[model samples]
Target: MANLVIASNTKAMKKLDKGTKDKVWAFIEKLSADHTASGLHIEPLNAAVDPRVRTGRVDLHFRAILFKIDDKLGDDPTFIYMGTWPHDEANKLAERSRLRVNPINGVLEGIIGELDGEDDRKKRTVVPDPRGELDRAIKSQPKSYLAERFSLADLTERLGLEPDLAERAYAASDEDTLLDIAANAVGWQGSALLDLATGLHIDTIREKHGFTDSPVDDTLDEDEQILKALEQPASKMQFTFVEDDEELRRVIEGGDFAAWRTFLHPEQRKYVEQNHSGAFRLSGGAGTGKTVVAIHRARSLALSDPTARIVLTTYNKTLAADLKAALLTLDPNAVIADRLGEPGIYVGGIDALGNAALNQAGNIADAAENVLGYRGAELTHNRTSADKVWRDVVQSVSSGLDAKLATPGFLENEYVAVILANKVTTLEQYAKVARPGRGVRLSRPQRIAVWKLVEAYRRQSRMDGSLSFPEILALAAEQLRLRAEANQGFFADHVLVDEAQDLHATHWALLRNLVAEGSNDLFIAEDSHQRIYGQPVVLSRFGIKIVGRARRLTLNYRTTAQNLHFAVSILSGAEYKDLEQGEESTDEYRSARLGPNPRLLECDNAADELDKVADKVREWLGAEVDPATIAVLTRGQTDRTQFVRALGERGVDARALDNNPATVGHVQVLTMHRSKGMEFSRVILAGIDDTHVPSAATLRAVPEEERAEALLRERSLLYVAASRARDELVVTWSGKRSELIHSEAGE
Candidate 1:
């Protein structure tokens, strides 16, 4: 009997037809049970670097490559599943491919040197390239290639990259060339080359690949010592033993990196498995696996105790729905409760959870009266009603206050950021509280006037019978605090929050109070650049401190390097902050994926733009890209309607995906705001023109002092939409483009 393990870097293995994959798994299972099975037809390869390397028949079309590890102790046998390939390809692969413990770095790796007839692929890759390989080469002089930046000696001696593979990567003058090299590379070599080509620091690469500062050891250098080599930290990321049928099936079904829920990079796994003392914050640019970490953290907690009351939440119900779906995807057996305060996992919007908790306590009106000065207003999650209340209050107080100070934006910001945040119930407390992040300064008189305006807004909201979401959060927080003080159990044993940046101060207070303050009390994921709602949250003020417990993910797994650059450009010139007030940087972030630089389609008018969107979508469909995986995002709902009508007229079925799950046979069209928490293989950011982006009507509504922040939020709105793209991003506009998007190429 032998222990069989699946190699982690099996991109080709994942692409097999489901029928072939099932047979491949069966082949491994049979081989593991009895390596000398007569019908298996496992034959040793004479051309292999390691004599034990062999190919076993998976079927007539495919052969499985396996490495037999002979334990020095004469223990039970062990085997490695290199992957399944066509008969000739498998035989050829066994000849050149060899697993070894890098003499210089100690990391175990596999190299597939120039396979038979690979020169044709070297000349031109089938990968998506807008420009041909020759043009891509011309765009890059030798100085720009990874070879020029890194010496061959460093690649070999330091990183232990196979010499021939290193040379192929060295001559890669363009991203497409690197893509070709990466495609041909096997196992760890493939991932390392792509990361190096993108200009990631060499030392960081060493650390990521499990290389340490210790001097090299010549004692354990044999390739035959496969069992010992598999124990290396590098091998930990690349190989996992196949103990059962389900594990093997899950492995062969999904591609590398695409199966983020299953395959976490070593760095990411550390965060998922590590323990934190108190509240922990994980921040990253878009696509950097912040949400992935959050979901896994929730899973880890639930797996620890299926009965531990755990609540996994995000900014809104739409995002919460996505999180719930992802939670199940990660673990189908996970228990998801339909309501809050349950013993199993409860995934919902943070405010929704708070409202539910308050309702469970059986006195929503009384709770509102205790926190807010009144109980008449009903809690409303509707943003429209909240905005209208702010507008009416501002209009009512316009005569007594300065025009700049009477704006609804300014008033609502003060009420949420200062009044509700600090629990200032009196005029004196409002006058005494500091307003650090607010754009405007207020004197004692101005503070009194602002307090009067907030009072009026509350009174009007009561008369209108509509309480804003933030007010409901305030009520919930006050009630939860009282319960905890009187020795009531927390709402949940653990709480996890994704997209923490968009939460208002009151929301944070409620979340902090929802779970008792202890280890793993709060796990927060946010990208400050994605803050399109409310004021920047200062966590300490809300009694949730993350002083030292913080981690950041720098590698993006979703969008290509090209699309990420385009999305990051939209965030240029805006200063972003973390959960704390410290600055958040997007400078060092890198994506392993590569593709065509973002494309821009400029039109003369909105009507013309809609037609072009349809044509471009048709072009994509003609290329065999899945229609369901393409998204066209608009700046407003009106644009969403026009695109839908235009696509329908052109005979392309398009659905307006408004917080709804995607369906088959239609391309999804969403507003930029609605596109949050959703991603597509191809995305078209429609209506990124000067008028629609900044929303000429929006800026006028913002007060003079707060215009800059409002404009930054507008930029963030587009950033969120653009980053939702996974492979290709296309920008389309009717008139002059928004100044936020610079005219430059990426990747």
Candidate 2:
């Protein structure tokens, strides 16, 4: 006499308001009483509605009843809409219909009823269910005992069936009847039932249950058969190469140039044809297939000698991933593994490779200990005493100067500026100038004063017990020198460096030690034009050949010819003088067209300028450009607060790229220094005025020789900013024009 009670909106049932709960209870009670009166034996219709539906456009409602004698009701828990025609349209349809079930669920139940309506409803068919069939099947075959071991309670709960019904279904005498009950219990049909049949070795049920078997095994072959099947496809490795003897014949035989272009760069193709290598270095621009040629070269070397493993290495993980992807495209069967902290066919990063070499020689630990000890000594009391002796001499020089010129405040200010500028260099030089024999010695008070200033400078720069960048380089060089002197050639088979132009003198010395014999083991690729970092490579001092054997690629493919031309014209160098058009036509590509003509907007103040910038972003969104493509390039993070705040006010999706700890977000407001090697569809170089563009923060401590170089780097950064706009470039300045814009504009 068990009956089911179906509930809707169960999630919100516990949180329903008191009044609504009461009404819902009353409705259920009335339905239950009506069901009993209709000659259906019934228990209480236990129903509940989610409180979330109270505020919803439609209310929670449903109708249910218990039935005896197993009368065919088409589908159980069927939904019916009881509202009269048009007047109730404005009202919640669910509430007005009385049975406030989700329309989608109601429609599904109705469709299922329609599907079942065509069946023979009068014939009360019954079969020996799953449990009886499984028991009999398992008993006849000892090997099939695993089927009988299944937990009946667990299966009943899993299938959401009554215990007796589940047991009867599981123990059916006929496998076909058991399978139908199993499929129905699990709500599976078609491919799912086929999967079940495959797992259980029950394929005969396919014919009995009137289910068609889909041919899914056509593409899937067993691994053992793969080698044997390859015999059928004999010409899979066939390839066509251009005949150098007949250039005209090859042009006549046409195929996709894009695929060929991927393997052969113009210079590399020429080099391969000639088969010559002197002191040549390929200086291909970023994305110019430098890595492709490197892989081809490595593969060619490997082909020449199967035993001679070629080592390929790059500066970082991203480059390593790129190189690995390129190699896989060339030869999918080739074995490629990471060379992290170890030597392999392919290694990565100069630091990693160097460390690997040191580790192999069993000297890394000793070298690290030596360097740490030397650094530690500088912070010791004995070292401080030695440093104080020099400080006293500096005070004597300052105290001897005329009182009018060397007043305490004036001397302090000048010394502080000089210290900040030179840092390590000036301190070492000042010690030489203030040697012990230098006559007019300092008084005790003056000695203490100078020592105070020196200590203050050291503390300010975080140089109390730590090595400077230059000192770290010097120590690393010393270790390499020591190793070289011991005749321990701890060298890599090959060395590859990225950002080569930024390497300092000591770094070049380390590179020299890495490839001591100069046996074509070193590959360096760099552009002097993009040397934005102040540290320039002093190639002459490193004892390397300086022939013009380096490959120079000048084509700018990332940006359109118009943008490229503008960038080269504006940047202060002859390096980018010969600007050429990119491979693809800029006009055809809608995403990479010249956007709004560059504008130099002048504003009354920073606040007014931010408001205008915010308005521009809103207008762009109105025009249907994605917010993700837009970026605001500023001088620094501190200067971008007003602009970012204004954008927020206007409900624009904007973020300060400098402030974002991780590299994410769509709309970015970034500093010029942080915007290198990154691009955007629409770039806005904001705060580009005389005062703001080259602010005191950027120009103050930079040396004279480095100023032009820094400005050139800044120009490169500007180029990077301008080129980021695939479709558009916008330059906004305030007050007086920036030197760069004024020079470029010829004003």
What number of clashing residue pairs does each candidate have, in the order they appear? 0, 15
Which lDDT tens digits does candidate 1 get at residues 1-747?
788867765444326777887787688778877888987888898867767677899988899888777766677777877778888888877776666666566666544423646342221111122235434443452664765566655676677666556656777678768865774665566667767865777888777666766534556435344666666556665776665666565666643423666566666666776778899888998898888988988888888888888889999998998899888877777888777878789999987887887766555665666667665646555432766776787776743677776777777778888888777777877878888788888888888777788888777766666667777788888888878877877778888899888998888889988999888888898988999888777888778888799877877878887888888888878887777999887876777677789988888887888888888999999999999999999989998988888899999989998867888878999899888877899999898888989788888877787788888889889899999999898888887988887888432
TM-score of 2: 0.47
TM-score of each: 0.88, 0.47
> Number of the top candidate by lDDT?
1
The residue-by-residue lDDT of candidate 2 on 497-533, one tens digit each, is: 5445544454555565554544455556555445555
Candidate 2 lDDT at 575 equals 34
The lDDT values for all models are 0.77, 0.41
Q: How accurate is candidate 1 locally (lDDT)?
A: 0.77
